[model samples]
Target chain A: MVIMRRVAAGLLVMLLSMMARAELVVEVTQGVEAPTAIAVVPFGNETGSALSEDVAAIVQQDLQRSGFFQPMARENMLGFPVQQSELYYRDWRIAKMDYVVIGRAVSVGANDISVRFELYDVLREQSLLSEQVTITRDNLRDGAHFIADRLFERLTGLQGAFSTRIVYVTAEQLAPGKQRFRLQLADWDGARARTILESSEPIMSPVWSMDGSKLAYVSFETGKPAIYVQYLATGRRERIQSFPGLNGAPAWSPDGSQLALVLSRDGNPEIYILDLQSRQLQRVTRHYGIDTEPSWAPDGQSLIFTSDRGGQPQIYRLELANRKLERLTFEGNYNSSGRLTQDGRFLAMVHRSGGGGNGFDVAVQDLKTGRLDVLTRSGMVESPSIAPNGSVVIYATQEGTRGVLAAVSLDGRVQFRMPAVSGDVREPAWSPYLR
Target chain B: MEIRSYIVPFVLALGVHAAVLALLSTHWMGHDEPQRKVPRHIEAQMIDLTALARREAEQAHIAEERAREAEQAQQAERKRQERVAAEQRRQELAKQQAEAETKRKARQEAEKKRQKEQAAQRAAEQKRQAELEAKRKAEAVERKRKAEEQARRQEAEVKRKAEAAAKAAKERERKQAQAEAELKQALAREQKAREAAARQASQAVIGDIQSYIQAMLQNGWRIPSTARNGMEAVVTIHLLPNGEVDQAYIHTSSGNAAFDNSAIQAVYRVQRFPRVADIDPILFERRLRKLSVKFRPEGLRW
Candidate 1:
């Protein structure tokens, strides 16, 4: 055990040394304290055909949803300027808009349109971006999203995640005794949803790999819980883990070289680290008390899992090489489902309040300070997933018995809910930064 | 009265006798021959002598008596003339003697009056000299008395003044010592109070400077949306004495670009902090010149 611990220390030293120097990550929950003002004027239709989608409105919504921009409402716009000659910068300045976007959508053919947009820096009174792209009628939304992404990146000096996708599981009650579960993938705004799988069995714990091209989850289809990895683009899937007692809680390692999972094959639930290349399983926990729900740390040097060894289920960190386990959480009696943030600075988990409530709520804790914060007052919350920027956390919550996905910024200041779909949605998995 | 009666009788007798002599001389000369008449009368006289003697005795006696009377009268007249001459001489002598006596008495009285005036003058001179001597003696005594009195008074005054001077010196020395002691104590107390006041004043200045900086930053900061409720950015800012921002950069970012930029922008917006410039240079350099402020947008939570 001592030699193994030494190896683990060496591994940690090597891994930490190889990693880039991490900047201090301060959790910000409050949306932009001063959201930048922007004006998205409706584009002039020179083609004279009735436009199906309001491209400017779509772009305005995209920027507004990011919480970093405050888009002026259409009624608030003083003038609609499509051409450079008609752009009265003083009008936008009077409207308190820092930037303005104007464009004209010209229908080139029956199926194609030429969309040209010019972004104006109203404060500086200069054109920031001018671009023209051809698209079909259905591609107008996509084109608008592209414009919003460009504007966001230019103004905030950070890459825009507006064009990203999110996959979630939804369950619909069909008959008196039957329920249908669908694994759905959709745009960031829940638009353009496409189902990848549908089954009557329950689906739980859907997680995306680091590349955002594959998803791993557990399904109760074979009369037992099994972990399956599915290729998102090809609809190809394979059952990766199916043990004697329990096979669930699949988490991908940072490099996609391994998966940390919980297995009960040895008569008790324990965490196991499976090497993806060698198909080798390594037991990471030896506690007789139940150990489950293993998640990989960002550096992949360790894994955090839930265990009931000391008493109630609490989170523990296990160094992979030496199998050294350390208790990470002591704030509450029941702290489980630990999910590490992208920066490895915080852990979002299912925490039960000390007042002995019947349900658990989403909570986050600073790993360095041992400070815990209960983020949600509403009970019965679970599946907390951090966004790619580590600024927000999306979780599955119940609102009057209807499961809905809600997102809260890490500091718990900004909270919003996704539009309700056709059925109850849960287990939301935010995609990584897209290429 | 006898002298006046004699003067008239003598004048008459002389006149009669002169007349008789003239007549007799005239008659004799005229009658040179009458010389012979006397012889004739002589013869008658003898006859009558007896008759005359008898008559004379009566007459003679008368004559005799007459003769005797005549003889007696002649003798009486001679006696009277002698008496008169003698009386004249005696009267002359008596008059001369009386004149001489009166002259002598007058001279004697004049001499006496002169002698009395001389004596009186001599007595007045003596009295005046004596009075002068007495007055000189009295003046000497008075001068001596006054001198003695003045000397006594001077001695007493000198002794009294010496004692008063000694007492005054002692009192002045004691007062001077007390005053020096009080002044020393007062100086010490004043020094202590001054030090305490300086300390309190400097502390107040420090507080004011801090409050000014905080207020300026509050007005200057525009917290970005990326700043969370608890997000903090520690920015080190360098400033000039005139309250101008010389340099401001993040010592530690809150890992949010917008948040860090917002903090930096706040520092830039203030441009200068005149409050810090108002503080003491030494204290400012020690505590406030290069200050690091932690900005937390705690109120920004929705």
Candidate 2:
């Protein structure tokens, strides 16, 4: 009996010891919001001559501008390994690179270059992506952006906005008083820009349709502010509305069936929804103050707009079904150009804080938590446009007394400036995710 | 007068004696003459005459009668003598009988005395034997009593000694038990104190390791922007004795591949925790061999 009890006690002790070493769990609730470091090795050129476009540079720039990655400089790389067989993971690992991109470009035809790229995790020594594309020399930059989009999506777990485009009005002072206001469309990185409309009158509030096939903006070419829908592929334009008073800030509904615009035909600047099919206008907000900048929610069930009915310009959500006007921003004196992200969980706006001397800056307010985060410190930032993936907000900010396009990550951690060559770029509009 | 009467009786007696003597003598002579005459009568057997013979016969008859009378007197005297002898014999016999009777009586008396003495001797012997037997029995009883008393005393002594020994042994045992109990208690207290100190030290080491690991992970983590506020990925990492990561995998996914992979990649980036290698091996095995990290991006804007 004594022996049995001793054995039992021994077993109990063993069991307790096992329980002690079951598992040690450590909780990590916070992490550095810094960009991931990646190595974009230069692509090997087998086209017999140097390609006009540097595909590696384009890919690197695209990833860097997304505010989620830090591409290693070419000079810092140990070797330019173009394929997995030649890739030495230890080199990148030593350089503290989390990921590596390697590729090679070969001429498939007289004008077509076939580019093959592969993305790898340096730490894991594993390949993440491998693809091949054939494109003309002119489209080589697009191919690089395409590769950047694929890598970005794989690395950040979000849709890459690199392949999308942005429309911003660039005012070039051709003369002392003559200003050429051009509604320009360009890549999201401000590359390959082209003017959709060039006029001496000012153009404002350029927004993309949901399908990314057309654009609707308030162009002043008709000698008054008129909303025009232009087919981007064909350069076809149509006047949607020409109100006697203010007709501006045209926003496309989520389904692209209607455009939500600001109109003062009712004796005050009010929010109106115009059905593109029926050409019928429906007033949604009847506020006495200037209610403008009507932006559709992703669900198209509601519109968040800037209204000054509360004695100060603030962001408000107007439910289209019930016309329920709920104030969305209370932390600022001037919050305008309220735009909801694709998920309708965050509202990015141009905010001027009530107490601080800081001028208009781009801010994002979490609609769920009602917490507002100022994403930019630029005193003159405006026209905040959220990326389709909600990872970044591109806005227009002044650089040395000239307006330039700049972007900030939603968490207010990463920022980059896109300075145009010869114009004051403003009212930047990020297009939805394009095909 | 007495003398004359005596003399007359003496004379009568002497005369009777003389007459008897004379008759006896005459009987003798008469008997001898008949013998001689019988021979002569035998010789003249045929010459008998009646008268002459009668006269002679008468004379002879007278002599015969005298002889006869003498013989009768002799016969009487013999008879008297015979009677006297018979009487004497009877007396003698009587005397002898009396003597024999006396002797018998005497013998009987002696025999009885002798028997009585023998009986007395036998009784004396019996008394002596009885006394000896009684003395021996008393001695035996005394001896038995002495033996019993001695045995009882010995038994009591033995019992007393045994009790003393038992009491001493019990006292010794009690003291030993008390000492053992106290020693055990002191040892228990010492062991408990040592254990508490060890536990505190182990806890401190564990805490240090936990913070070290947390910092390493945070610095290496590149939170994917797609990781929303509520999404969490749990990763388990196995480490070698040298604090190098042997294996790391997602224990629970956040449903987002990139987010989960980011957490895994963070562990891979750290690769090793040098602080862990410095800790005690036992502590490492118990608490740091396998670790679980929960990657929750609460710092993100969305």
Candidate 3:
């Protein structure tokens, strides 16, 4: 039969060459962003009379300062297994450990203790998070930052700004020419800081209050630069319409009934919005150029601030319902303190790139791919804030000549340094996720 | 010789009885003349005498005296001479019987002419032996009809040479089966062109180890900011012919467990892939064992 149709066409060309060589795939797209090693271990105290606070070194310094984790090194742990049947996952997968927390604390009631933790996944030997919490030995570092916010929201599906709170503005030269500005409020890992308003004069832009209880800064104590909203559990302070010449940049509004600030008293520094129940100030922007740093837009229908109109200090966007003034940064001519990302699709700021003597860093941009990404090469970074799980950004730089507070990670692959025991920390803000 | 053939026919029947008794008597002639003359004379005399006799009687007497003399004349002639000698003996018996019938007819005509020349010499020697036995029987029937026509031609020339050798052995066999089918179709077309050149050189070494495992998985991926541009995942891995990683997981789950553990920590951060350890173990067991990967972040900023 014609040799059976040439042996069935040579078996259909060997079954189409084995269906074109079955499975090899390969895609990937792009990555190398780094950091997620984790291991925390060491918690097991079982309260044998000494449990002051270690809760696994405060969840290994809050997942190592949230630059998205690389924790390990507790003398290089091979075995502090608090439970999961004494956990041996090959001793943290031979110590290359991708996540392993473990737990213990226990002393349940004379002053209430309980703690207990778990979080595993060491390369999927799988137990992702067990949990226990109790508290009160003076809130054991707030129950170890609520177990590092449930192991950073079960490994970064994002919502663990380590129990959030930051609010900077330090200054303190205290003697040479007498400078003592304060505004402080801490714990986003500058530990429990506290002094909310001390000022020898200049206190600058503080911000936070879409329900993290209130604190709107730029204080100059009353000689000038006004704007103070305070109320943090009643260390009370109000001062809003001090319109003489520049009641500095304030912000607030994602329905805390409006605040927005920056007002050159109708002369130059534009952007206004006040409303707090119709105390109505609303003059958005007449723009003669110096419209100061205002930042609202988590959909308060717009206002992104800091402008030089076109000549230099960039960052624009106004639309308070169609008043529409849009220039949103065109890359480096000193882009100013912008802010955005709570899904506003990224916009951090304070860049400087060559149009100035090259010093101010912190850039982010992407607002749907306008692609800027210069997340800090340090040089004197400034107020860049962010982190309500926009993964991180904390800014305020200058280390050797002292101004501290650093942070980074929105894919600039994690940087650290918060250094603030005494003075020079400048304008930081980051607060929003606090229930 | 049987008596000279009866003497010559008895000497010719004695000469014919001597001429008839020799003229029998010729004799009886000569003498008798004389006597008669005498008698006549006597008679003449007597006649006259008788007449005279009477007269004689008278004379008789005279005679009687003479008579007695005559008585003798009487016996006379004695019986006349006994009759003249019986007539010469019956003429010599008829001349001896006619010479014995002419000597038996000349010896029976010479025995019928010598038996008719012997019987014509025996019929001429039986007609020359019957013409030599009819020419020898016509030359033995003409040599048996030419020997039966030379044995029917030599059996028709051996029946034409055996049909021509059975038609030349059927034509060779059919050309030796067509040259053994054409040498088996040229050895099946040279074994199908050497198996298609060894399957195109192993498909070019499996496309260079699939681009060196896609640049070692994009330099060990890290993506997870809850990685969102249609977050994919997939992983798989399983290597070890020295390319290491012997097992990576997350076969498919972008339901985000931190984007599938950042794609199984980017295959354990590329634990090894030197260049797939310089390939070809049968092209790494046919195309680098198990790979998959995928992780779709699309250069993130999600």
Candidate 4:
């Protein structure tokens, strides 16, 4: 009877094996047109030590969070090969995996470790990367992020901002009407969060420098809004401007030599470029109406800023070579906070789609083709920051009463949210590609 | 040279002789009376000495003339007789030639009869040969027709047998296919019956979970004023096995924020879905862990 039961169990397993041939792929259809299929095997640990983090899992999550890859679940992986020779290309191919990554961690010292990984093209039967790196025990997550960034760049032919960071403002309620506002910086995937500034006032309009080493933002810490630049590696910061009325929306030039900020010291809130070395001011916009939120073009030859010169809050481009101003957005009644892409071909902003400028959502406009795409359908969204590659845009949106950070692809295909663990988060600022 | 020269002279002499004879005859007639008178006068003049002699000579001449006359008359009579005999001989010869001609015509008639008989015999022989040849050809043709008919019938019989074999084979194939189809149908019916039993057993557990959750959410949901009946919002809900809601967010919007907020609120307000605990664990994991619920105010009425 026992043998018969064993035979029956074996038959059942065979049937299950046949059924397993039909894989269940969780397709993030809101992602890009075609997402790459990848498998990140559980890393082989040879150190005889209990690690705190799963490096391979972190890499997998990072790739998936980018909305460019559909990482296979760890349960579906067949083998955990630590070396290239042990890898079976046919097995990964049968699982419909386009790429496979395997790694091993070896202890090098009391606290240091050497982590090595190999990325293989299952279809091409070739190794894309096989490298080793030395890092401390706590740096495995960062090492995984670096490996993911390298893989992304190699596969997409563009630099990956996965290893970069994002700065945003988070508000926590202390009492009925009291709150604590903090400027927090974290990895692009919302991991390893660290607060740089915490105050009772608000923080808005955080912008990254060209090299991604410094941040320029408007802080209300001094009882009035002031523009300040802070170095991230070192904890050094200085107040750049404290003009009266309005000194907000500070944007860094591409060469890091100047800042185009909103200043209402004259009559109306207009755009002004301040030479950082000489501290000299150059007025860029003069209109009876409000002109603010000056964003420098990637080439630093022109500035795209929000203005109501045409009787509505529209985006306008101002050429620095000559003082000729041209209106950019003419579709909606209220279009503001225009952020140009690295090529100056696309502009992402908060736009009021319809209804007398009441419903606000994130939108991206192609400058060359004169086409506009509304990225978010839900209104009441703001502060859209574009990635360095211009493939995605992250914006601040409200979910019920809590503010959350949501990202949408420039093509309006994908949408995901990075909800804070506690408190409300807003004003997302995507950093440039970091070395 | 010799015969032409003689013929020309002889013709000329004959012509001359004929002309002279004609003239002499005419002279003699004219002189008939004159010649009688002159002979008498000549007798008278010879009178004196030889009267007696002359008389005697005259008498002698007369006698001689008479004799010559008589001789000439006899000659004329002989010549007439000869001419008459010659005419009779010529008549006899003509009668003999006519008889010979009659005999020749009779011989020609006999030859013609013989040739006619020969031609008739030859025609009869030819007719006999033609009849024999016609009979032989008919026999040969009749024999060929019999042979061909036999061949055609044999070929038809072979073709009929082939058709019969083909029909039998096709019938067998159709029967085999029908039997297979009936067997497949029986198997399918048996499988379907078993599946129906199993599904009926689990129907309450699986069906009640989704419906119960949906009902609870709908009861708590408030359709916003900005929402139309046809607008829908899809929200993805993540849950743990203990019926605790891990996360709930909107996957697709209805283009109206107030309507979307209401739908999101409904999912969150129904904090737990306890019906999932009654279902199989595998079923819950597969179907309910990450469930997407579409909230359309129009769907509630239907």
Candidate 5:
């Protein structure tokens, strides 16, 4: 009986230790004080042949998705040497890159290849790891993600699950008045795309729940646009918001407790904070002009929202306390789609330029510098969602014939397009930093 | 008993982590100086080249004074040899010219003696013998001889004296030509040297200007070391186009007076950092005109 107790105690000890190690893994409740800086240069090709997956770019997307590594754009890369020996640390340091990654692929066979990669700590001036692996052509995308996962773990001290997916909406014109729409999800780097929903009506604003398991999006299936939360695993969906007038822009609150959206049942389109538990709605903003596109700040105290109350669709801030509303955007004649940084120090928004809509760009305003940086010179960008690290944002835009998801770094260095294989994909919302 | 056994390892890990965190956060006093290390510039450069960056961490740095001394010593050696060789060549040319002048004077005296012997035969007889009979012929011959002798003497004197005079003239001309060439060369060398020196000086000045900007930025950043975690503040900053701060407000308080002041001062201290002077003022105003800044002392996520 005494021996049995001892054995049981050892077993219990083993189990508890396992669980305790996972305690730090509990969704990283406390993020790093200073967000890491990562420089993701363009992936180099192997000497023998060309590769289908731009592995470097995919790796960049995977790292950027984690919201731990702030990816520096290839355009901003002063110098990118393929081999570790050729890497010039000064160039990266000048760009304030904390870590720099270089990679290349070698064709082992007609259908097989060995991809090689390394992550270097620019400040520490050391290669964090030399993780090299070989894979078939079918698994090249997985291989790129695997490298990203390893780097993410070493730097952010958290495991990265970006080898997963992205679900979004794509729209197209079928005829003069009729339009075709499709709901789609793809690999994190925009490969292996498949359609989830297809319709003639418009589908927009696809958002992922805290866990990447569920989605809440705006679908116009029932003759009018209504908000629906769908479970990806069981293909189960429940309409969360449906009203007579305008029912649009449904964004899930950070805690998954409530949703902040825009509705016209109150006569004008003002922001209404909906309680997910009680199904009770509280009006957050009351304005004459259009008040829409509400996004939650890191702390749930206040929400940064878009309103034209001061004239034009500009961003406005509403303090949940006393429900006081203040105009947040006054610099731009036309600014919309305001997304706050996780720290709430920076406001990333779309700035409209030129007379009568000739030019538009995505801009970032450092609240500290009072400095505005135009992140996207590209004309088409909508629904820009900043990553948890405030480094990059993914938004909806027209790419060729389809509406695809593209990302722009807040610092204006990196740009990427995620186009699905079937139908058009748009309105990409990056998930909060996943555990 | 079960809890007791679990407590040891748990406590040990926690203690080690806490100790390390404390050590890191405490700002250990003496470790601030990275001695026996490479220069900061070299350290900064090494990041680019993997091997070199690694090398920078390994090598012990030579003192600045010793390196400067070695460079100055090399320059001194080069100047010493060039000056000594120039002085030796000047002395050798002067000695050779003195020996040649002595030889030329002795040769001129011997030539005058040979001309005197040749003119002695016709000297006395031509005065009385041909007083009247050959007066015409004598006068003609005497005139022709005198003319020929005069021409010979003039030719000899002109050739030999011309050689001496021309040599003097050539020497003077050579000296004048050399002086002009030396003056031009000196001016050209000086001009080239001045330009090179100017280029170097300007480069240093540019570097100083950049360092001054860096100093201003570094001093301006001013994040207080004592800022505790869970620090939350809302700062609203207004901007002018061209990315300059027009005005800033501490819209939300972080609780700590010093921290809040530091945050406000950092923007002011920037003095014009994130300098986007080249961007269109209109675009800067439109996009980045007004913004809010928040800081969390404890990590932001929960």
Candidate 6:
């Protein structure tokens, strides 16, 4: 029952997300300054390696609640060095602090972690951005929001949405308090909430880091449920093969090295791509049965999931180097999570078939022609986030049982909410636009 | 050269000192008999005849017409000597009547001389003489003495030459008509006494020129009353000789600069006038020397 963490890559995993030999000195242009200031520190795991969360403090409260930064607070740090020679540079230019993020988390083995970060320019004392990301404390909050979206695009020249990935849900105490169902691994704003696996039994699909840093979840911890890779700074973890019947969906690989998951391991659920420099998990899908949500394609050469092999749940596009699969959504019978658009051109999903109470809204299809754009007006809208200049949208629904963390502007004018201090704030993850 | 040169001789010792210049020149050094008693009363001011009584009455009427022409030339020399003696007594009576008429006719013709010596001759003859002789006696007495002898010799030569030429012509015609009527009544009484002495010398030369112009016009002539005639002025008076007016000249003008300034303010309001008899000394230059004043106001006229 997990939904939404959809990323469908195609142009060959967007040319293997670089390192055709490695050095491509970046140049993606266009206007950048929307709400975008990012400072994210605290990744130094050293080796104790139990990163439940804190990937640079969940990418600095996800780029400071995305209202664009005035963020230098961490108790007013002028120079917080974890490496790069513990930089000084006039104490961040006497604390004016334009950019000075730092990162560490070393112990690269048993629970795997090699996260190195540097992002300076405290008034030009050099080093605009450096990176070394290898995460396993189940993907150190997706490698600390993927080096905070590449040091928020190298000190704000823009596009470092602190590497996107935030899938929240935290109902932390079962007795002392009341919430017993939570789902949260925050990095896009709700800071370092690192419970990659807690539940009164329920969790959902949270997939990211094809350069966003990391996530991929759907956890009932492991009862009749499975699928996980949790490290957001250093609380280590991983579990990508729970089988017996329909494992769940998990997407990544625009090159955080690969993972487009949803697996019954093989008899029924489909889609897979787990490379990690060749830990090699390939099986694109042979569909002898219903397929589940599997997204990628920011150019990981094709993959868009949720398939009932054409009978009900639709939306499919496979082509990961000729494992050619097609049927990409037809009208709607019950479309599920389909997040594509970082300009692969539109997909935001979850438009269930309307009939009874005209339920589940939030739509938007347009991958060049299959137009939809439904956007919500009343109730159950969920998990949306497409800002970083894709023009606003942040989501989590249920206004009545009150899980509230809404935001919408993708042309439905503007709706809002960031609510929750008490109870029902459910699974809401909207990350991407940072740097 | 110092000390005031000794005070300049003590101030010249109180003014030159020559005994005060001999006590002011000769005061009484030679007084002489009261200076001959005041020049003898100024020599009695010699011009006496009561100050020439009309120039001695015109020199006594020109010396009485030169003594009446020397008394008519002595009555014409006494009638020219009585006509030369009656012409010498008529020449002596014609020399006695011419001798007695040539002797009385030679005595009557020698008496009828012989009277009739002849008468007779005739009768001579006859006389018869005697007879008639008597008749004739009468014829005879003859011529009677030849008429008494020629009347006695013509009456003695006519009575002696008519009584001596009638008494010398009757004295020469009574003295020549009494000397021609006494020389025409003495030339009509000397032409009526020379017209009464030129009518009393022109009435005594008009009564001494009208009492010396009424005693120099008795000098009371004033005429001020703010003097108006044709209002002339020109004043400048300056006088003193007692007719005072020390300074006057208000310059009255008639070229009418305000009626010659009111006739120079009426000759300075008639400073002093009253004295012009013999006019004191022509009154300091004939009085009112500068008075060209003309404001008549009808005062003094001719």
lDDT (10s digit) by residue, model 2, range A339-376: 88898999999999988677999989989998899888
Candidate 5: Cα lDDT at B69:
65
Residue range A1-435, candidate 4, lDDT tens digits:
568655765565445445533322121111113346789888899888978789898889777766667789988888888888889998988787767899999999899888888888775567988888788888887888888877766555456777788889999998988989989998887788889988898888889999999999888888899999999999699999578888989999999999989888997898899999999999988888999888889999999999888898999999999988899998888899899988788899999865664688998887876777787987889889988877678888898998988888666656778746478989999999888
lDDT string, candidate 5, A25-109, tens digits: 0010122233356787776777476677777887886776444446788888787677798898767766776678887778877
Two-chain DockQ for each candidate model: 0.05, 0.39, 0.23, 0.01, 0.01, 0.00
lDDT of 2 by residue, B1-302 (tens): 23235545645875786688668756755644553344321111222235543664565566556656787777866566557755765675577567666766776666666667656655655665575566557656765665575466556655756667787788888988889788657755764575467568888888878888999999888887667789999999999889999999999999998789889989999999998889877668778888899998875766
State the TM-score of candidate 2 restricted to chain B: 0.51
lDDT of 5 at A423: 56
Residues A1-435 of candidate 1: C-alpha lDDT, one tens digit per residue: 568655765465445434622222222222235566789999989878887888888889877777677789999777888999999987887776667999999988889999899888775577988998788888777778777788777666567676777888999999888999999887776778888889899988888899888989999988799989999879999888577888888999989878888899987998887887888998878878999888888888889989999888899998887878899989777898888987788899999866665478888898866778888877888888877766567788998879998877666655678878888999888888777
Model with the higher lDDT, candidate 2 or 5: 2
* Highest lDDT scorer: 2
Q: Residues B75-122, candidate 3, lDDT per residue (tens digit)?
A: 545355435433433343343334334434444454455455445544
What docking grade does candidate 3 earn?
acceptable
Reference-based lDDT, residue A364, model 2: 90
Q: Of the pair 3 and 5, which is ahead by DockQ?
A: 3
How far is A274's C-alpha from truth in model 6 (Å)? 18
Between candidates 1 and 2, the TM-score winner: 2
The local distance difference test score of model 1 is: 0.75
Per-residue alpha-carbon lDDT of candidate 5 for residues B18-135, written as tens digits (9 for 90 to 100): 6885686446423433521322221111113365435433431332234356657755553553355345434533543444444444444433443343233233233323443375
- Candidate 3: TM-score of chain A is 0.39
Q: Which ten residues in a row have the lowest lDDT in candidate 5 chain A?
A: A22-31
Q: Candidate 1's residue-wise lDDT over B1-302, tens digit each?
A: 33346656656975896689668757744643443343221111111223322431232133334445568667876567557745864685577567656766765665676667556655755665565466556656665665565555555555656666777787898898789778657754765575467557766876677677777877766665555566777888877877788877898887777677667666766667876677766455555557777777765432
Top-TM-score candidate index: 2
Chain A agreement with the truth for model 1, given as TM-score: 0.83
> Between candidates 1 and 2, which one is better according to DockQ?
2
**Alpha-carbon error at A227 in model 5, in Å?**
1.2
TM-score of chain B taken alone, candidate 5: 0.26
1 versus 4: better TM-score goes to: 1
